[model samples]
Target: MKSPKQQSGDAAERRAETLLTGRGLTTVDRNYRCKGGEIDLIMRDGDSLVFVEVRLRRHKDFGGSLSSIDQRKQRRLIIAAQHYLQRQRWQGPCRFDVVGFDGSHEANWIKDAFSA
Candidate 1:
């Protein structure tokens, strides 16, 4: 059984997926895991592949949800994305995005949040 924290995270991912799909992005994969790291959501926006990281914070303390993804986290995400691309043989355009949820606040979607 999933712990409450894990369940909450799943719900957050679902919310992020819904928000992205509402904006015309289609889901490619979810919770993709490899040895290096895991990707929360893989989506397609137009001809570009999108690697999204979803973060949920109950409070805006210590920089909040968006600030949680620091350089180390970004590196892990990049590593995971590369692994995915190699497995899928994807050579087309791709970008990283971040979806942050702070308590009951609206979602904050940051496109091209980082480069590989």
Candidate 2:
């Protein structure tokens, strides 16, 4: 059985996928885990690969959820992304995206949130 946090994270990733699809992005892989970290969603926007990080916060009392992805988190995601590309032999353009879900059932998608 998954813990509550795990379930919530899954739900959030699903929501992010739906949101991205609505915006013309197609999902390729999801919940990609590695030694460095996990990428919530890996999608394709046209010919470009997109690595999405889904952030959900019940409230904004302690900064926004997207703000929680600090430098260390970014580095971990980068490492995981590089590992994924190397394993898949992917040589296409890629970008990082952040989908921040505020409690009100809306997620703000930040494209090109970071670069390698």
Candidate 3:
């Protein structure tokens, strides 16, 4: 049994996935988590590996979903990404992306949103 909020989050992630796929990115993993942190989606863009964070906000106040990803969260995401790459044999270039969704509009993708 999932709570309404969790269900909503799942739906939002699904929507983000669809939008990314439409842009030609291939999904490699979902909800990848470890002791360090969690990554919402792991995708591939051309030859680069991408780590994405999906945010959903009900209103435009306080910067909406885009602004919700503050410094601390970015740190966690970076650490998680490093762990993921270490586990895999991949030594190629990678970047962090953000997908913001405001309830009234379509999802927005912010590529290379941050770095290590």
Candidate 4:
């Protein structure tokens, strides 16, 4: 059985996919993983390659969902993205995006959330 966290992640990915698609982004990959780390979603937004991190939180007691993706997480994502590109031999324009979700309060799409 999948852990609760895993299940939550899956749901978040699904929501993120729908949201991105609604905004005209085409999903290329979901849960792209490597030795470095994992990328929640990889998509194409117009001519740019988009690497998205999907975050979900039940409430904003400590901090909002987006705030959870801090510097350390960003570094890991960057490393993972590099690994993905190296393996795919991808040489194109890319940007990192964060899709933050907290129940029923509009999902926030933070584009170029971090640098590679």
**Candidate order by TM-score, highest to lowest?**
1, 3, 2, 4
TM-score of each: 0.99, 0.95, 0.97, 0.94
Question: Which of the predicted structures, 2 or 4, would earn the higher lDDT when compared with the native?
Answer: 2
> What is the full ranking by lDDT, best candidate first?
1, 3, 2, 4
Clashing pairs in 2: none
| lDDT for each residue of candidate 1 in 7-85, tens digit (9 for 90 to 100) | 9899999999999999999999999999999999999999999999999999999999999999999999999999999
Please identify model 1 stretches exceeding 4 Å from their true place. none
**Please, what are the lDDT tens digits per residue for candidate 3 over residues 1-116?**
99998998899999999999999999999999988899999999999999999999999899899999999999999989989999998899999999998986988899999888
RMSD of 2: 0.9
Residue 37 local lDDT, model 1: 93
User: What's the true lDDT of residue 42 in model 4?
Assistant: 96
Encode model 2's per-residue lDDT on 78-106: one tens digit a residue: 99999999999999899999999878768
Which of candidates 3 and 4 reaches a greater lDDT? 3
On lDDT, the leading prediction is: 1
lDDT of 4 at 50: 94
Q: Which model, 3 or 4, shows the larger TM-score?
A: 3
Q: Where is the poorest 10-residue window by lDDT in model 2?
A: 100-109
